[model samples]
Target: MDVSWEESVADSINTIYLLFSAYLVFVMQLGFAMLCAGSVRAKNAMNIMLTNVVDAVVGSISYYVFGFAFAFGEGSNSNPFIGTYFFALKDIPNSTYDYSFFLYQWAFAIAVAGITSGSIAERTQFSAYLIFSFFLTGFVYPIVAHWVWSSSGWLSPSSSDMLFGSGAIDFAGSGVVHLVGGIAGLWGALIEGPRAGRFDAFGKPVPMRGHNATLVVLGTFLLWFGWFGFNPGSFDKILVPYTTTSDQGNWTAIGRTAVTTTLAGSTAGLVTLFGRRLLVGHWDALDVCNGLLGGFVAITSGCSVVEPWAAIICGFVSAWVLIGLNITALKLKFDDPLEATQLHGGCGAWGLIFTGLFAKEEFVIQAYDSGESGVSRPYGLFMGGGWALVGAQVIEVLAIVGWVSATMGPLFYALHKLKILRISVDEEMAGLDISSHGGYAYTSHAEESQPRFYADYARLQDQS
Candidate 1:
């Protein structure tokens, strides 16, 4: 098909922003790599890194081939559950750079797969993980994403319009991306069971320390930085001194999302640090990182609607929720290596609930197009909606958690019965780095004695 010069220029500009967004999302893969590697025992460091890299590779291929079609197939179907099209990319128009759009979304599919690595690290079988990654990115993640983000999705008004009164209000994927990824992690962990010695015979929890705090910290920072792009780039409509609005509405709301996301993140980090200091008798680095992550998850759903003060409130509350969830997991004997369940599932749920409670009138009006007679969400406490919005929030939380957990529980039970979810006892003892892949992150030789030397040096300095 022939194209006009102006159309070609517009397409070129859109392609640039799309590529930039893809680059930002791609950086998240490194974040997962570092975070997962640093969360596990040093003996299994190489194995964790290998899993992350390969999951991205396999996930991208699977998502590209079938997942994209299943998700945004541009169909008129009414089903709110699954997508319609089957492997139908060739028919997509070349002018729209539909392939580029697929590439960008495919990157995000792999990002979701990466979220699970930290949860099931060390004990998960390489082969089982491969199968899980393939299915998850190709079918599971994309279907949910399409439901929330695609215009033709049943959740959107353009389609069924019956199921979603508020159109599944996931502004930045509190449920579609984070919760789906976290719930999948929860299931995989339950089937695989706790790592050996992670809990005592009496079911007492044991702390499994990371090999490198440096790596973990680095990964956390990268994720925090990449999120700037993740939340704002979701608009997918970047333009000059002012980003263009989608045909749906003015996209400048993306700026509001970016600002709120930053505020919540810092505020949550500080609260977690101090909260842990009071509880654990010291400033806990791990809790601080997770707390910041909780804030990121919490603000995601309402990034464009909630006011600055509301973002602060959401951040503070989310940190507390994150710490509580971690404690709850331990008490319940759920051994999540990096606490994926708490940071993503637990806090992600809170973000969605808070959005319903705190979403402001002006922002909502700006972003959404209700019919002349349509009713709007009452302004939250700040806007005077009071108890009504909070009540709606409560319903959203119960529905999301119950739906995800119920679907996941039986799937996990079946995988356990098949014995495909976990590595054997012998393999566990040998360490996944050696047994599963015949690789080691570190060799035992001269470096093995370095810790002793460092300890001795510290003692000598103390005496001096």
Candidate 2:
């Protein structure tokens, strides 16, 4: 075959691979919907589910308009902090990136909003959801994505002037996507305060379990499945050969990444299962599911570069990180219905640190530098690469925390001050489904009558 024909064929295959991955990632939105629906009380299920759905719908428009531009837009004027090109997808499908890449990134942008929604799920105003979702996907998240994934990003491993000779190796955005979402959620939950009845007069925590365990399990599985695409598909191209003469290629690294993800998540689930059993005296599926997701979040930064055994260590540590955070949150009387802030924020930071400690040298070269030999770059600290990579990872963790706090913290605070961030006390107590959305998620004759019955009873009591 002619060289031109071969190049065209390769391009077609890569595009197909990326598009398939994007579709898989998109399926995660459904997972988040189910997870959120299952994790909240029956009264607030509809409200939370609505927020999850709007996360995707609203995120799509905002990301298309400015998120993609601020993330990966490349031109002579493009800076490291934000992209100035590709506004509204102008000059897209160019030689460097195609539409499929945009679809993939958009899926990621929406996932960040989905994460934040979980933290402020039951108590947040629907209008607040719309405003924050749009702003996050349009501005906050894309800037971080630019800082890590874009070529010009100072934190990007692919940058010309690498930080510490090995810019942050967030292969799949443990810091960028997960940390940003988690920190944003942190500010939102802090601003909104806990849901009603979450704390008693003594300031002790109360048990406000989700309405459905089945939906939580289902959502967890779906997210687990979608993560295959989330981590492995970050490669963007599966056809590239690692070495011109070697049989192994990017395809091999893809498989290894998938393995690492699976191992880490599985290990975390098991650890959380037993750990929680020891702490709480029983097995909790919901806790395990969250632990599994935490593992996935932690390993995402180094899935391509870490060994499977190292992934297990990452998982093990992440489970405890989650547990400790949950305990601390409770001690502080801070409440997040879905534990989104703890799972994503605490474990995501650990994942970045884990990558800095355990990333393998050869694997790093293959994944980041396209297996180009003789390229002097730092690797994991434990692997004898020195403190450079770990230092970079630490800087990344701090920078993300600072940036999200600066942006999202103010946005949430502003919404709170305006009295629009959370629903009214009566509306919250009655449930957002009936008060805001106009119906129950699982409506029945009795369920429908109960609300009216309560209204009449309250009116009668007031009259008496």
Candidate 3:
């Protein structure tokens, strides 16, 4: 075959690979919907489900209009903080990126909103959700993506003047996607406070378990399936040969990434299973599912560069990180219905730190495209690299926290002040489904009669 033909074939393969991955990532929306629906009380199921559906719908429009531009638009004069070109997706499908790339990224942007939705699930007003979801996907999340994932980003590995000679290595956005969403959720939940009756008058905890375990398991498995694409699919091209004569290429690294992701999630699930058993004297499937997700969140930063063994370590530590955070949240009376802040925020921070400690030299070189640049980038500290990578990773954590706090924190607080964040107490007691939406998710003859019975009772009391 001619050289031009070979190049064409390579481009076609890469495009197909990316489109397939985008589909897989989009399937995660179903996973998020099912998981959120299962985690909240039955009374609020419909409300939470609707928010999850709207996350995708609203996020798509906002991200397409400006979020993608703020993230990856690189003109001749590119800035480190944010992109200035490609607004409204004009001039896209250019030399640098294609529509498939945009589709894949849109899937990710919506996932951030999905994560935040879980934090304030049961008590939040539908209107408040609409406002925050639009702002986050359009602005807050994109800025962070620009800082970490964009080529011109100051924290990006592809940056010209890298931080500490080694920019933050968030290979798959543990910090960018998970941490941003988690922190945003944290502020929203904090401002809204816990669901009604979530705590006793004495400030002690109350058990507000989800209404469905089957849906939780179904969602967890679906997320696990989608993660195959989430981690390995981040490699936009799979057809590039590593060298002219070598058989190895990005395909090998992609497989390794998939393996590491699986191992980390599996290890975290097992640890959470036994650990929770020891702590609470019962094997809880829900804890295992969250632990598994926490593992995936932590390993997302270093999944491409870490060894399989290191991924296992990442999972184990992440499980405990989640458990400890949950305990602390309870103590502080911070009630997140789905533990989004703990699982994503806390574990995602740990994932970035884990990458700084476990990333291997050869894998880092192969994964990061630093070999051609002749720049010997820093690897993990424990791998004998130095403090440079560690320092850079720490900077990324602090910057994400600060940025999300400054943007999303105040957005939620303003919503609270406007008296539109949470529902009224009577509405909360009656449940969002009945009070806000039309009715309950599940209904029966008995349930149908109860509403009329309550109406009659109230009427008689008023007359008397």
TM-score to true structure, per model: 0.86, 0.96, 0.95
For all predictions, the C-alpha RMSD in Å is 7.0, 2.6, 2.9
Per-residue lDDT over 147-211 for candidate 2, one digit per residue giving the tens place of the 0 to 100 score: 89988899988998888888999999899999999999999999999989899999999999998
The digit string of per-residue lDDT tens for model 3 on 1-464 reads 44598788888899999989989999999999999999988878999999999999999999998888889887654578867655746765554348889999999999999999999988998999999999999989998899988888999887788899999999988999999999999999999999889999999999999999999999999999998889999998888766532677889899999999999999999999999999999999999999999999999999999999999999999999999999999999999999999999999999999999999878887777723435477999999999999999999999999999999989999999999999877677767786677567888622875875366445444644
- Stretches of candidate 1 exceeding 4 Å from the true structure: 1-8, 75-79, 157-164, 239-251, 369-411, 444-464
Pick by TM-score: which candidate is best?
2
- CA lDDT, every model vs. true structure: 0.74, 0.90, 0.90
Cα misplacement distance, residue 182 of candidate 3 (Å): 0.5
Of models 2 and 3, which has the larger TM-score?
2
1 versus 3: better TM-score goes to: 3
Q: Runs in model 3 with CA error above 4 Å?
A: 1-3, 76-78, 93-97, 370-375, 445-449, 452-464
Candidate 1 accuracy as lDDT: 0.74
